[model samples]
Target: MSHEARQARLRPTLISFDVFGTLISVRDSSYGAFERILAETGAHRVDVEAFWEHWEHRNIVHYCKPYRTYREICELSLEETFVHFGLTGDGRLINHYFDAFPRFFLYDDVVRTLDRLSRRYRLAVVSNIDDDLLALTPLQREFDLVCTAQRAKGYKPDGALFRYLIEHAGCAKEEILHVGQSQFTDLVGGKPLGLTIAWINRRQLALDDSVPRPDFIFADIQSLNDLVEL
Candidate 1:
């Protein structure tokens, strides 16, 4: 807590962010797409659990086995949900889900805050999405660097992606800060990679003392901008 130490973290040369829950809100866009999908396929009344919990669990398990795009995951999820609820997994419904899936509204403070911080730290996005959409689709303005599973050839919660980034970005382990919402992806995976990670605990999930801890934690992004000065 000395002025001298605070000065050191003032400007990191590089900061990487997780795309989905951290920088963009995919809930409305993704679920809305699924709503249309389920309706067209004559699916049973939408079970919220299918969309949020089961699909997420399924996707992570699927992605780790072999490479897949975020779009592909969405497609498979539609099939899985339909099968679980005993509905027809029609091709038309799957296509509808894919078409609407890419639309995501940015978080409230994303643009201004990123612009403000971009002045000081080189900003990049590291995500498990397909190389193109995951890194590029959501934003019109360019990021300094963007890394994806297609490029990294692997998924997060695996340290390889983060390690490749640090090597490619040409930054030291301690200087780079990673911000993400998933404790599994951002904290546990990023720990061995050696970056100082800030867990964006958006849902206010209780901390598990058992897991590897984050160097910094914020329940919401409101406090994110202040991190450059921490």
Candidate 2:
């Protein structure tokens, strides 16, 4: 551990993580799944990159409107993407993606970081995902508490899930550190609740002024352990 990690070892009682982008490489996994499905269907003309972007946009729109399983949002957004592209999608394609979701790989550093962090602090997950889908990920066993949008009936940026974490985990707002890759969902959303936020900028994206800045910014979870001793 570094000097900062040594110095900050005992403050937080709980550490919460945003699941999809922070721990798993959702973008890569989604793109690969889509690419394979399109290739199989001979939908070679579809612009895979553009299609995925539109799907993501639609997914976010649906996520904010009402409570739905993450799989349902994915299927709905995919159909919207198909309509936008003038392609009639088969239901099988949606199922294919859903099945592949659980298989999404974790970031190389996640397992080791979680192993170390779990030893020091109570670990929890605050995710935009549904309980079923989240259970499919390898991280299911690592966390002491797993709070999801499904259980909260709303997504991140809505605050329900965070409230659930606080109540269920029996931790005070200041005693928890929220770590995630999304500036909109995790950092901006959790900060106002009086929870310390750590922005895991795995992509090294430039900061936007409109979002609330995080208390700490790390290139990845491994670096986080360097600053806070897991």
Q: Which candidate should be chosen as best, given TM-score against the real structure?
A: 2
- Cα deviation of 24 in candidate 2 (Å)? 0.9
Candidate 2 root-mean-square deviation in Å: 2.4
The sequence of per-residue lDDT tens digits that candidate 2 reaches over residues 75-166 is 88888888888877763586766678777889999988888888888888899887777777767575788789888887777677777887
Candidate 1 lDDT tens digits, 39-141? 6766647665465466676677666567666677756875776676777766346565446535677877788878878777788888877765653446666
The residue pairs that clash in candidate 1, if any, are none
TM-score of each: 0.85, 0.88
The global Cα lDDT (0 to 1) of model 1 is 0.72
In candidate 2, which residue pairs clash?
none
TM-score of 2: 0.88
- Candidate 1 Cα deviation (angstroms), residue 161: 2.1
